[model samples]
Target: MSPFNNHLEVAGFEKILLLKFSICVLFSVGVWVIYTQKARLSSIPNSKKALFFLLSFIILRILPFLIIYVILDFSARSDVRMFYDSALGALKLGFVYRDFETAYSPIFPYLTALPLLIWDSAKAIVLEMVLVEGIILWFTYKYYKNSLGNYYLLLYLMLPAPFVFSILGGQEDIWMWAFVLWTCFILRKNSNWLLAGLIMGLGLLTTKALLVLYLPALFIFAKKPWQFMLGLLIVGIPSLAFMYYHSELLFLSPIQQANDPRTPNIWSVLHPLTNGFVPIGPKILNWVGLVSIQALGIFFAIKSKKTSKPHYFLVFLFLIISVWLMIIQQSSLSNYAYVFLMPMVFFFGEQTNKKWLILLLLLNLFVVIQPPIWWGIGMPIFHSLSDLNSGYKVLEYITEIGVVVLLFAFLRIIIKNFKTTNNSNV
Candidate 1:
């Protein structure tokens, strides 16, 4: 049985379950309204648009949690329970890597634990997540406001995937992107390379180790590699020293995380055929994926050297990360799609392709609903081949295929842009 199930009250569980279904229904209605009233929404004043988005975000994301945990006094489920466990463990142990094990960065457990210093409840960790999400949303809006307009923000806010993954699952996959977005804002001046590197180094320490995969894009785009490297070393050295002082276990976290079960990915889809065995094995596939991402980053850098546009950079960065998520073993959960939300909005906001937009919306719907269906039926959120059921497996296949198609479409767009840039240069 799941840990949260042990403490769950029947009345609370039923209420929360009903609330989840209601939120999904409301999200569907909101999407329909947005689609039918696009012209009317676009005509609204910027101030009102911002206010509406904020209010809607709070209602959909924040209020439900407040109702469930605060008023209803229910135990949080899914990763939030694990997060609370890690925080409490950190508080008791006093050092994260040394005294305990966590797949997250060294700072993450402590950061999650910070809220407990105030309220001393697991709900505090969820509140901390909300705050982190708010920071991410604010940075995303500020950075993309002029380039993409309010429509992109509207879509991001209204999207069910972001709400489900970030709020309901309490996943922090997008936390790394928050620092990336802030660095994007800083790099707008072109002379802030050092500061950007410093911020990224801090991100490396606090957020997912996957942030390292994004470094190639930053390095390729840097005006002065030496200055950026210097700034990275400034924080990198101290962070490394701190980790070393704590324990050698700190360096093993990534390897440990890599052994986690595969999810909503091609490997998982093919698992039944292989009888839950990979012909090439996961470690080899992981290395191949990493090497492929590095090669793609280099190829994109070469093709787009003359294109210093910020939006193009976002596209390339998204491509690199998307490739990693698509191919890498043990790393392709549907929730990871949240990382693509901001970049997708910024990259495709002006495109008139209804097919791509429709595909994206369908992908979000499948991704959002899959979790609830699986959990509601007592299936594990991240499952092995043996754990699969026909009901949940169908959604998994659809969501994975949709992601693959969407990613290929993005690649086509990037290639087309590259060709346009080259022809214009000639």
Candidate 2:
């Protein structure tokens, strides 16, 4: 069997039994490590302790996942496999567009292939991801206030959504988030529009969602727009030139992705009423959502002119992301919401108001927590709870609604922040 085939290994009673045994052993070790390290990590001076905890957590979690996944040869996501194939096509097959029906931006094929270059093993790719996540979380801790640094790190690692997505799903969203956070971190210290723009450009190649960051970049470099454009063009021009040779495949992902129907988004509720799984949507609403994204982007860009603080831009960014999640039909996966959690932890962790924090936690748990046999049994047990159901259709709609509620709550917090900031300025 091909290693990349997801259907064969992830199914069957034997595979489930093996996976369960591995998880049980790994969980026990993780608990033991935490218990033993608690005192030792606490004994370190506050200045140095966060890094200690961060690395310890990364290893304790990553080591088990690395071993189990390799032993089982668990399926990497189809998206990853597709990107791998696209990369191979690029490298050995002359990188033709229709060759693999490449749907992603030009740079992604190369980015995904970097791990394959290091080691032919799937574990190596996952390990590289774990390392990159470690760095992102470490800097997140570094930039956040010391008192809440450990809290944020623990929240990130222990969260169910992030955990499953990182280890099992092997989603590439973290790479995009890491680049955006790094860009913002640098901009926080100095006004380097060129570097920030370059980072944004690079990030876009990995995940189109990073296009949202352009709002903050525009505001930060409002006076130096030329520099921002120059930096963007530096990276973007080459990709465009490469795509020119690759032909129409450059536009395929964006076009098809916009209409692709996944679940657990606002569209889930509407899907039954609309065309069934045809990757189409209400044309008018589509236009509206697109306009709203741009309108909010422009608003944030204008509002950011008043304050030079990077937090102002971040606050605006939080709102823009919420709007994007709320409106974008393409964002059907619950994991897409992971983009908001990092910024939330950094800015809201220290806040006295726990409403948004609590809501976000509930949201993460609702989306991430899953029965062990979800894939093995072909569906979660909850679907059978309602006999009136059409194969878990009701449950899917409920999950999507829950996500919508959490998003609106978050939007309220954003509005409150803008009001408070305005009042303080006056």
Candidate 3:
């Protein structure tokens, strides 16, 4: 690279960061002023105030992710180990119609390709991510506006992890989750079923994380088959399209799956463990892990005195996890960390105290590091299991360690909840 060109890129990227930082800071101050200016939150009881503070504390805890990722991009953005790299390759290598040869739904990578075609720079692409993320933020705040006051909105503002996905890896994980949530809100309002289905379906194609949506959809649409069917239709069409076009090529090719050296899900990490150690298939372990966690949660959930639409959401999450881990591969570290959100939103809404909140926060920290380490941590773990000398070996090891601990942790919580519930019944 020419020194002049290098200098220009550095100068230009710095300018962009300065501009973004300025805008974000100003926007944050405006939001804070609007929040404090009103008497809406002032009238809340002292306890709610405290709960609000703790929740916001958790959100703010990850706020520095933006700065760290912005720097990481300079060095690691081109790293082939990133999931985004594989997704992007499908587009950059001209495999749009033959997405099966690559991994994942082609839409996200195609979008990434679009931005790169114009600017050919990671900074510009991430800026686009920030913009899209900002829009999602606006709608997210809107979704909770009626249910949450300033305290809750503050948590949304500082939601460190989701924001990090946008700022750092240029990941579309948040959008997938956000769209699925939007579909839920729309369904709650009795809005368009086809649109909702399409929204969720597209979310599914983009990231496996949205596979969680299908769990909720199953029960909600169990009796209402049409809605469920419609969602499947919408969600599956794009993926099927890729499959149809690439029928000669392998579907769900091993190479595509092999891209991730570490994943807690059976496809990437579990099967390898069995091959290296036990004769058992990782799929078997996955089903056992998922179903065991699920059955206990659902059985307890149904028996609990509390039965509401929101409670049903928890059941939906339980089902999602059951099927997701058992069936899908490539569920990432952040994906597992996402499980903590369930307890936080659920227990907090139930008026469970700060102690419960703190416990889940600690658990969140634990689970957050599981599988396909997001930022280079799990490489060694992956290497240990896949091939100790390979770059991704450590990723497997950590994934193995993480999964064992998480499996035990998930079971422990379920048993604890069950025993507690039974004792209360007695």
Candidate 4:
């Protein structure tokens, strides 16, 4: 029988199950979350309300795991054989066993396994993540006062995709949120590039390893460019050194997942759209397309009307696409759907109070309308591709391509800003 069928010898699955049952019985956080807002709303004062509300929220936040736990206990047992393979690989390599990751480091696997040893059944991981992600959101609101409003933290915690990912997929991507936001805060707000790059490097563990996602914004927003660059190097150089040391991995951390020969990427999209295909022999074409996407995004950033803002948005879009591409490239688009949610939040957030936040929000509300996931322009194409069994690769192509266009459009806005700056100087 496979490890999944047996639940590995890591701390006895039965013991873990007993422990979780005990915890659930002792603490009704999940149940409290289910009825939180309504229960607490009319009773609390304004000052303590948000904080009380947050506690109730964490319950719902952590509820998915409990539900999954029930299913896992009842027979919907997950084939964690894959997880075991990854962990043992780490052990065998004496470098932390990481399965399913060929091009990247073992940090993420360790994160998953570490939590399981203590809490059992991925619940421990999500619990830690909710707390961390919640703190980071609070930090964002406190500092970026103008950029955020009251209840934003609540909203971030409660977003449907985030809710599902945390409870269902048992993802730790939220921790990455802290690192990414830290990079942004330090480099853009505090002029600490070295720290920024380091945090950004650390952030790679959350999803894909993309160091420069927030750098362009630093360049645009930094009042002191020299200090900013110095800070960037401090944080970024260490990871770059590691990548080089593991040069065996070929510095492919960012796009390692995309190198899968099976899936269609942006370049693959070209084959379908152009009615011509590039032979998949050497990897030169993939590199070319990847570089082209970054270059295109950067070019738009330089050309936009609001230089700093566009730089941040473009960088954010690139990071989002890079992660989406990594997953879809392998034809595994399950549970990681939340990757699109953050980018959507930012894109729409940018236009808030500009002209059509109300209109856009209303339209987006319709997307969750009935039965199907209506991602607007994506619904028909995604459906057709699914019917053909090419859904995974095609979705990858569409999402990344859409990100590229949105990135470029935002870049155009930056170009206009630069021109205005130049003219003012003249």
Ranking by lDDT: 1, 2, 3, 4
lDDT per residue for candidate 3 within 1-426, as digits (tens), equals 533233222343434334434444454454445345445654566557546544553444233334444544453232213444543565456564344233445455666556666655555556555556555544544454233444444533433333334454454444554555666566556645566666667766565533543444333433344665687686686667766676534544533442343445444454455654532334454445445545544555455424434323433444345334433434344444443342233223233345543443333332333322333332333322435443234533454545545544444554445334322111
Write model 1 residue lDDT over 134-224, tens digit each, in one string.
6677666655544234556666667777776666677787787777777766766465778878988898888778777777766776667
lDDT for 228 in candidate 2 is: 70
Per-model clash counts, in order, read 0, 0, 21, 23
- lDDT (tens digit, per residue) of candidate 2 on 1-426: 432233442345445435534543454344344434444533567867755675766565576576657776666652556656766766565554555556655566665667777776555556656666677777766666444455556655655556666676555666666766777676666868788778878876666644644444364435566777787889888877776766744445555565544445555544444434433345655565567666666676666666645534654565456546554654346666666666665554444244544565567654553222233335322322232144233434565567766766766666566545432111
Candidate lDDT values, in order: 0.65, 0.57, 0.45, 0.43
lDDT of 4 by residue, 1-426 (tens): 432232122223334334433433333243234224433333455577457556746565545454656556422122233444444455454443112443334465555466556655434545555555556555655444332333334434544445544443344444545565565556445445555545555666444454344355445444455665665576457756764566555445446554544332334333445444434324675565456545544554455435444225433544444443432232223233344344334333433342332332222222112102212113222223233233323434554444333333434443343334322111
- RMSD of candidate 4 to the truth, in angstroms, is 10.6
Q: Over all chains combined, what TM-score does candidate 2 have?
A: 0.76
Clashing pairs in 1: none
The alpha-carbon RMSD values of the candidates against the true structure, listed in the order shown, are 5.3, 6.8, 10.2, 10.6
What local lDDT score does residue 331 receive in model 2, on the 0 to 100 scale? 37
Question: To one decimal, what is the Cα RMSD in angstroms of model 3 from the true structure?
Answer: 10.2
TM-score of 4: 0.58
Q: In terms of TM-score, which candidate is strongest?
A: 1
Q: Local error of candidate 4 at 159, Å?
A: 4.0
Candidate 1 — which residues are off by over 4 angstroms?
1-25, 46-53, 271-281, 310-315, 371-399, 406-426
Comparing 3 with 4 on lDDT, the higher-scoring candidate is 3
> What local lDDT score does residue 114 receive in model 3, on the 0 to 100 scale?
64
Q: In angstroms, how far off is 348's CA in candidate 4?
A: 3.6
